[model samples]
Every structure is written in structure tokens, then in C-alpha cells.
Target: MTYRTSLTALALTLAGLVAHPSPAVALSSVQWKSCPAYSDEVIRSLRVTEEQVPAFRTLMKRLECGTVSVPLNHRDPGGRKIDIAVTRLAATDGSRRLGAIAVLPGGPGNSGYLDPILRSALRNKEMAGLNERYDIIGFDPRGVGYSTKAACPLSPMGPQEPGTMTKETARKIYDSQVATNQKCGRSDPAFLGQLTTANVAKDLDLVRAALGERTLNLLGFSWGTYLGMVYRSEFPEHTGRAFLDSVAPPWTRLDRHTKDAAAAAERNFGRMATWLARRDELYGLGATARQVREEVARLVGAYDKSPKTFAGLQRPIDGSAVADLAKLNSTEWVRAGKALAELRTTTGTTAPPTVKELLGAPMMGTPVPGAPETLNMTMNLAVACNEDAGRTGFDTAWRAHQRLVTRHPATGRGWGLGVRCAGWPLPVQETTLRRGGGSLVLAGHLHEFMSVYDWTLQTRRAVGGTVYTIADDVHVSATRVPECAADVVRYFDTGRIGSGCAGVALPS
Candidate 1:
């Protein structure tokens, strides 16, 4: 599985940013030390907070945190420096050790510094073998964590914004995002643009050197899966066994990705409708799936024309609020369905506390400057805006949103009404993948809304891999559930995926 990035071509295309020739000696070896205890404020404030911190602390005491010095610009190795923060959990049984595997965090910006310590805790049994047999390493990619932060105000993720996706609101959102893009880019586009996946892959290889390891095995979830593929393409020789959970279709277009996600959301909602219809006696949603769908749509449309205030909500429950709930995962369908049913027929001035609690932020305040979560918000947009090459034109985005919401009302409004990365100063950098690798195993969920099943096939078409399907409708469940994790453990242990691995941890 030699995947050398069409080196000849990438070398030229990348010019200075990637595909280096006669490259300077890669940086290796970090100065390791006991990790300092991160404050609970910092931990809890993180966008992807690991809540089991109190439990992970038992193993956290054994963790080592350090920094490996790399070039701010890979092409200019001797210029200013960047420190990639890392955490390592050495093998408990060195005599039986295989090798090291770097655990890449998912968010383009989420901190991975704590991943090795937290993910390998005794409670996270899926990673037990990795903890015992090899050095499990985690790192904060450049522009994240202690590495460096791209300081830019970020638009809130999910349905954090209020209001319906009318042409007026859509156009306004698009304009504002475009403005934000122009302003954020001017804060050192040349330097910030270097924070691409290709560069991160280079950082990973350097991290490999730091460990004195010849080959690195891998395990990545969600967006982490995408990063692993890029690493494989860049340095396949150094990549050993890789288990990519929730494979992101290498189709790198943000518009396409989000649009597809909306479709998945709609499909999952339909499944929920069927489930709710069967329990009509309890939910009183409807006797049939079609009627349930219609009732849900009618409720959402009413909110579109006239939003209403529940007893405890800081803001009114608008169409977007109801529409946003349309994309619940299979696990949340029951709770969300019950919430929706109450809203449709409620005679009280109060709404369901659970739903209101779930809609935690009706009036989002300004992001706290210097908060731990700030790093994520800034970097996610900076990295996405830096890479996405799509339509920034307001007219196109408006027309697309109108068409989509009309067709898939439950999911369409959530797709796009804003021009993402509009007027970003950085030139778009592109990547090409060639299919030949087979050391990779991809995990796919049959009806999961996020990273739908088709994307798994799409990714496999680009690079060869064995895939096992989860007979559930949840995202990234393979490595988390005992039955599904069997395949992953087997792949890492024997360099082969196990067959007939079954079941996921479905909630009662």
C-alpha cells in the first residue's frame, strides 16, 4: 500500500506549502514531562469537552505532555518556529510492545493534548490493547491548543442562530459571513493558510520521528478519519495499520458535504417518524408515518410565520428551533419525538423542560475571549475557510437553500443560507487521492445521519480499504461499542479485520 501522493505532481502543485523535495531534516524528539492538571473551567469550556475527566485523572497522572519544534512554514525550516503540543502514554508492557500510534483529534481545531490520557482510561476499554501494547500518542495540530491559536471570531456551530431561512434572512447571513471572511483573512492569510491537512500530515510524520518509531498505527474518529487519510496519502510508508471510524467522503467540498448531511438528517427524521407512528397511543403524534411527518411540518411552518415564547426560553421558539430538532439521531428520536408531540398539542404556557434544556442556547452571548472553547471556534472556521473552494456568491447560496428547504424541509433550512469562506484571502489548496492502499479498515453505520453510508463507498473508491457496516443509525459507533469494536481491535492486533463482528450499544 504505497500511496506517495502522485509525488511528482503534488511537489509542483504545492510549491512551498507541501510535497517537499530535498526537504530539510524532519524534526524529531520532544522533551517530555509530567502533564500539568488542566483546570476544570478549561476542560468544561472546551467545545468537545471530555466530561469523564475525573475518571480519566487516574491514568492522567501517568501522562506526559511536551512540545516538538517544527517550522512555522515547512518550506522555511530555519525561520520562526511552531511548537506542536503532544501527550504520550507509553506501553505498559514494553517487552511485548508493537509500536506507537498517534491518536489524531477530530475537529480541525479541537485539542488532542488530552486525548491519549483520556481515551486510554480504563473506562475506555476499546483502547485498552493500544494502551498495553504500544505508545499511544496525541497532539495538538498547529493553530490549536498549546501549539498556536488562530484568533478569529467564529460563527456558532449547529442551529445556534435564530430565525427561519427566508430569502431575507438567508441573504443577510450570507453577507455577514462574507464580511467576516474578508476581515479574518487579513490577519495574516499567508501564515494562517499554511494550517492545512497536508501540513498537519507533515507534522504527524515529524511526530513519528520524535517517537523514534519506524511506522505509526492509527485510530481516528469523525473528522479525525479525514486527517488519517491525508496522512496515509502523504507518507504511506510510515503508516502501519489505520482504523478510520466514520469515514468522511474525500469529496472535500464544504457545500456538498453539508448538503449531503442535511439529506441524511431528513432520512433519519423519516425513520423517527415511522418509529413514533408505531407508538401513536403514547406520543399521539399520528397513526401513520405520513401523518406524523405532516404534523411535524405543520408545527414547524406555524413557527415560521409566528414564533412563540415558552415559559423559560430566553427567546421565542421559531421555525429554526423546530426544524433543527428534525435531525435527531436514532438514540435521541424518542426524546425528541416526545418533545415535538408536546409542542404541537400543549395547552400550557410552559414547554417541555427537557426540550428547552436541550435547546440550551436560545440567546447566545458573545464568545468569551481567551476561553478554552474559543480556540476551537476560531480554528474550525479558519481551517475550513482556508480549504473550502465553493460558491461564495449570495445568489447561488440563496437559490440552493430555497430549493433544498422546499424539497427536504426537515433538513434543508439547516444546510446553507450563508456563503461559507466567502472572500477568504487564502488561495484554495486542493488534494488528489489515488486508490491502492489496503492496510486501512473503514467503519460505516447503515443509517447514520452524519457521514452517511454512501460516503464510505465513495472514500473506498478513492483508496482501497475493507469496510464493516454497523446495523445502527448512530455516528462513529464502531470503536465505542463492544461488539463493533471487535473488528477494530482485531485489525490493530493481527493487521487484519475480523469478520462477523456484530451489534452496537443501542440505548434502552
Candidate 2:
């Protein structure tokens, strides 16, 4: 049977099972225990240091940690089981407590288990209200964080090197990516095919059952929005109030979604240029936004011809690097402009201090010594590849890249969507998500590059909900905008969200 047909059959089977209650069978309750100990190396991989362990432990004192056993393949509940790591902060006011609220962080790979500590350290006060009446739950999805991890070899070509628009360069990158994925498959042959969003949603349902909650509230960001949608679709009867922040469109194809992301980045770049040009006296890049954009393009061309080397960075900063940096949101435009200006002033010997510091910092591809390969990146590949049923071969990927470069030259190459899952050794299981009859509050920022505002509208329409748009450049609305955060908190408390795009706070 086709993937969609199987999904339909599964949905019907699940509905029938639910309709005909089976009193004989019950899901096993979670065996709560003290959180498992992690080595210093593992702790560091989570970006928590040895010095912070005492505080983290102290924080954990007030919460509970455990693992939920879930089937490796949800299609067969009697199949091999895997452990999903979970953390819970019980509601302070149990008298008024609502059900559990599962926090799903973005990156398909990001650890939700660490979100509580990270939020505490960042002083995120917006969710303080919800914390009073809801048990805030976080978990590492299967094959991520403290969960059973899936390891893979790094690409042999090293971190994606800046590419020239040549067939040879594209071919080399594609082969390297494929080899890297193949290596991951070899490393964890049994689990790679199971690390999909649909399976993750199934694992989530198991978590809810173990918590003894019949329903759950969902708070999802970026890729998490997609997960939330899937959860609502499969288990709509078990869904409570949902707050989807920085929504991602329901696109099954990775290439198309990435192309849309590149276009959005280009639009965001335009906004940044306009903002910089208005402050021309301070930045001195250009008097008009158009001139500023043209100047940026010119600089990219000049740097492409001859890359600049800094004192601290191992690799030289090239045109591609500049273009990539330019795609940053409006908040970072000033820094980007400063870096550009410093590059323009290079006399082939002296490097500006700011430029040196910026270039010296570890970028996306920078490999840290002794650091474990992140579960986020690994699972991202697994999930994206598992869901994508469209063309992922070298030729198709090359054409996508070419189209991106031609249409959105400023940010296309930097998007890095090409050849991501070209050699993923997994069968596609496309999810046929149906809109659940649940009230949802979707939120987005006007300037979000990755999850653009259009995605919010599309998702809102798909799920039938009110959208709370923030007139700001922040990526995730709830974290940055107070009003947006208030809406989320209010929605959780009362099943309604106040509408208005008033408060626009710029990121610090």
C-alpha cells in the first residue's frame, strides 16, 4: 500500500479502537525516578558547564525526571521499545491545575528537556502565569538529547565549504552529504528509519498517558509547530489548548519549504537594508535602501573575487560568507554593516578588531573538540528525510540550488537546503494530517526569516484558529514580544486570545 493509504487505514483503525473502548487493556504507567547521570562530556554537549551542575541539580530538586517506554514503531505497539527522556515541573497551584502542557522546542533536534533550565537562566517571565496552573512538561524526542541517541559520522568534506556555482562543486557536496547520511545509517541501522515526526507524535501520546492525563496543552515553536499539528491530527480528542509559535507551513517537501525560506530571507534582508539606510548618518552605508542593497551586492562580488583572511579565523571570509551574514534579521543588521565596513577598509594587512572577533567566533559548521555530535542535527536529517517523498537526488537538488541562486542570490547558497537528505536510507512515510476540531492560537513575527509571517496565515487557515501577529522582527513572537507572550499565557489560562499588533519590541 502507498504511504497515504496506510495512514488513512491507520487513522480509521485508531478511530474504531477509540469508539469501541477496550477496558481490558491499559497503557503502562511511567516509572518515575531520579534523572539519569550524564558524563561531563554529555553535559557540555547540552551547553551546560560543570560549574552549573550544582544549580541545575538544585533546580531539578523541585521537579521530577523519568523515562517513558514507547514502541520503536507505533504501527506495532508490541514492537521493540525505546526510552524517551522526560522532565516535569508540577503546577504550583494544584487546586486550579489544568492538564500537562508539553513544550516542544524547534530544530526537530533541540532538546525540550533542557528548555526549563534554559528559560530560567534567560529570565523568561512571560510563562510565569501558566506555570501557576499547568504542569510544564518537556522531553527529548527519540534519538535526541538524553533519549536513545543516533550518532553519525561528520561529512568528509568537513563543514560545508563555501561553494562555487559549478556542477563539479555541487556534485562533490552532494556526495559528501550522502556519505555522511549513509554513515549515520550504518551507525544506527535499527533506529534511523523510526526517527520520524509521526513516530515522535506517537511517543508524545505515550508521554501523556504515562502522566495520567487524558488531554494535553501544546506549546510548539518553529519545527515544533509541525509536530504539534501532527499530534493534534492524530489525537485530536486528546488535544487541549494549543499555542503554535513561529509556525511552519504544511509542506512535505523539504526543497520547496527551503526555497520559500530563502525568498523570505531575501525579503527580511530588504527590511534590514531599509532600516540601515534610514540611519545612514550612523551607518554610512548608503542614503537609500536601494543604494545600500546595491552596495552589499557589490561587496559580495568583490569579496568573491578575492577572499579576506583574518588573524583568528582558520578560513578566509569570502563573498558567500558576507551574503550569508547579510541575511541576518534587522536586529543584527548594525553588526553586519559594521563587519562589512571593516572588510571594506582592509589594506591586505591590518584587520579591524571587531571583524577579527566576529570571524573568530565559531560558526554553524565549526566543529568543537570532544563535543558529542548533536542529536538535533542527526534527528533533523532523520525526520526531514523520512517525511520527504519528493525528488532528493543529485540532479534534482542541483536544479533546486540553481533556481535558488538565480531567484534569491543574496541568501540562496547560504540556506543550505540542497543535498540534505539525498542518501537517507529510509522509507518515506508521508503524514496525511487532517485539521483537528481544536481551538488553536497561532503566532508569528513580521520579520522572522526562517518561519515567515505567511506561514502563520497558512497554518491558521489550515487549523482554523486566530493568529496573533507581532509587528516586530523577532523570529519567535512569544519569547520576544511581551504582548504576544501575554496572548499565549492568557489563552492557556482562558480559552481566548486578545487581538492587536501593538507592542513591537526590538531584540537586544
Candidate 3:
């Protein structure tokens, strides 16, 4: 998945701040135990197949699962306590082990627990080297994953179809979001107040203490990079070597981030067009980048006029859905082009299975099984709505949306942080711009759709660090690119990372 697609889904799905120094909570002792069995629903949600369940379970058996109690309100440690679920894969070479390395997942709500296991299962050789020397830790932040969860009444409104929502429709959607917020606030004001990035950073320090680590090595991706930065700022003395991949800009507001994302989407879409044109013999979309883009525009217009209903799709396919298909990774461009070609032929034509599956994945709806009912959405909203330095009013959001649409018509409608958080209840938490002068490394793709290259430059300025650039359109480094992966491991092993790991060229 491209960073844009994942972030867009997260924007459509989850929905959070900072505050004054709270009384520090000492990390209580924890007893490690065997990981509990995962339900079929949870396994499927994790994208683990039923056939791999046994192996997954065996891997889980080797790991330890535990919980650490932390204050519900950091300001008052003696107040209500909440459990933070944690998992650890011990170092294989305990004799040569270094300190703990925590893997923070992207979504403010994404489970950190699965990353270590997933990396091990994939036999990520670079990560394997780090695993040999460091205890890989994963933990769900408060109100996420296996930790104490916060619930909210489901919003009746869904994401408005791109380019289709009018003033009245947008207002109704905004109203529904406010209603959902109102309901949640009424139920648990304290819990809602505490779900900020600063709190999560504090919780992480507690986790580090529980693991008996004086200093923490960090591997944070996407939003995790933001969390890692927070940790670096908060506990500079305790931060060890850190790798922040697909970094979020340290000072960019949510609205600016959205705008930057839209601009990046436009650039990435052009790159996709170039890639697709080179493969015209296979996909038959167009002969040049311009032609391919024109063809896409034509198709979008036609589909918007008369939406098509593919077999098994709950709703008819519209221009917004077709445009969104382009928002995927470059690897999926050919498939998306082919899918678009098939859809343009006949309204009744059944979409290719791949296309159907991609399109059928719910963009907005109820939370999936085994996922927290509202934590993901609520936390995202809480952090974004609170930490943002710009206006959070509906008018500002609507205007920004309009500007984004005007500038990048292809994937603009789904770009900005919508008006749902316009009237968020939490007080704005000023973002702290400090960074730990540790051995830090940040990486980004030149054509990254979500965390754009500009963010890397901004982050480098905000936090002194060396940047490893991948000249292609990949989202997070160290995931698919071997060079990037090796650089990450190399940095962790020896506090030095070489620059200029050329990006892999997309296959034509």
C-alpha cells in the first residue's frame, strides 16, 4: 500500500494533543506470560491466513505478553489506572544483546504488537540482525489494540463521495461527527481528555522502565515517527539510536499536511501515468503520460455521469472511487489501469477480482472485529484536532478542501482532514519542537504520496539527523527496499548510516 492510501484510510477511519508536565508515573513491575490465542476474526484482520495460524501461534508462544498499569490522567498518577498491553520477542543472542528496541507502528491506533512478529515471519534479514542484539518490543498505546479501550457511538454519516458533497451534505456530515463527539464526551470526559500523543509518549517511557531499559532504541514508521520524535523530545536522556522512517513533519499543521499530501498525490499520479504509458502494450490505457492522464480524466467524467455497479459492491462505482484507485502504490497501477479500462466498457461489466476486492474494502463504516470500537477513530481525531495549530472550524476545512480540489483534481476530494473535527472538544495542545541530540536517522521517498519529501527536509531542520533518500515512490523505507532496510539495521548496529540508497525503479 502507498502511504497516501494507508493515511487516507486512517483519515476516513480513526480520528487526537499535548499538555503540561504531569506527575511522572513509575513503571510498575510486569510479569510476562504466554500470548493469548487470537480469534479467527483478529487473525484475518491482521492479514494472517488460517493456514499460517499454527505457525503464528508457535511464534506467539516464544514471545511474552504483559500489561503495565499507568495513570489514566498523567497529571494525577494516583488517579484511575489503565493497562497498556505489551509484547516482547526476546533477543536470540542474549549474551550479546543490546538494549530494547521498540517498534512503533504507523497509525496512532495501529497495533505495535504485530510488527515484531510480522518482521520475523517475513525473515527480514536486516531486522533479523537487530533482533539478534536487541529485545524487540511492541505495545498498544492507551485506548488501542489490547490496552484499555475507549468507545463512542457510531456516527451515522459516512465519508461523502468525492466531488459529490454539496454545502448541505458537508454540513450534515459535520453535524453527525459533532454528534458522535458529543456522545463520546458525555460518556467519558476524562478518557477523552487523556488520549493525546504526549500521553502516549509518557506511556512509552513507562514501558521502557518496565522493561528495565535505561535507554531505548527506537524504530518508528509513519505516525510512529511523530511518536518517536515526541519520545526524543520528552526523554532525550533515555533515547538511544533512533530510526524514523516515513517521517511526519515536526511543525506542519494537519491542514498543511493535508495540502502537502494532495500535492504529493498529484505528483505521484503523474508518475503512475508515466509508468502506465510505458506498459501500454499490456494495460492499453494510453501511449504517453499526458494521454494516460487524459484517458483517466475522461473515464472519471463518464463514470461520474453514470456510476457503475460492479458485482458484489454495495454501492455503485463513481468518479471518486475510480480516482482513488490511482492513489494505490505504483505496484498496483497496472492493475488499477486495467480495472478502469474494464469499467469504462460497460456499466454492468463485473470488475476484475483484484479491482473488486480493492474497491470493496470499506472506506468508512463500523470498526472491524477485534479492533477497538472507537479508539482508532477517536485517538486520530483527538491528536489531529488538538495538536493542530491552524483553524479547526468547518469553514477553514471546507475552504481548504475546495483549494485542494482545484489544485489537484485527480485525488483531491479525499485529501484534506475533513470538517468532522471542526468542533472537537479537547483544548489545543501546543506541539513541542525539541529533539534529543541522539544518533537519529530519517528516511523518505522522493515521490512519497503521504509523507512528502518536504517533510523530510523540515524534519531534518527541526531534529538534527542524517537523511537516507529513496529516489522512487515507495512509502516507508526498510519494508520493501533492501538497501533502505540494510541502512536501517546498519545504523542500529553502528551509529552511522550511509546516504543515497537509490530507490528501486518501478517495473514497466
Top-lDDT structure, candidate number: 3
Off by over 4 Å in 1: 1-22, 39-55, 153-163, 361-375, 435-438, 499-508
What tens digits encode model 1's per-residue C-alpha lDDT throughout 1-508? 0123354643343355533432675556797766766565554554334766565556677788888888767777777677888888888889988888788777778777777765544435776766778788888888887786667644443333456666676666766776677566655554576877778778888888887888888888777888888888877888888888778888667777767877787887888888888889988889999988888888778777777777877756777777777777777776787778767776676867666766656444554445433236567776777668674587777776777788886655545564777776556776666553338888777778678878988888888887877777777777667766656666777887664244554444
**Which parts of model 3 have CA positions greater than 4 angstroms off?**
1-18, 39-45, 49-55, 120-123, 158-163, 347-349, 352-354, 364-375, 503-505
Ranked by lDDT, the better of candidates 1 and 3 is 3
TM match of model 1 to true structure: 0.89
Q: Assess each prediction's global lDDT (C-alpha) against the native.
A: 0.72, 0.72, 0.73
Put down candidate 2 lDDT per residue, 1-508, tens digits, no spaces. 2223354543443232111111221375676887655555555566676777666566567678889888776655676788898888888799998777898878878778866554432224676666788888888899897788766665546654443557887787788888777666445545777777877888898899989999989989888999999889888999998988788887677777887778888888788788778877776778898988878777776776777666667667776777777787766666777876777666865567656656666656554554433446778877787777674888888888778866765565565646777876555668766788368877877777778788888777777777877776666657545556666777888898876464454433
True-structure RMSD for candidate 2:
5.7
Candidate 2 or 3, higher lDDT? 3
Q: Which residue pairs in candidate 2 have backbone atoms (N, alpha carbon, C) closer than 3 angstroms, thus clashing?
A: 109-376
- Whole-model lDDT, candidate 3? 0.73
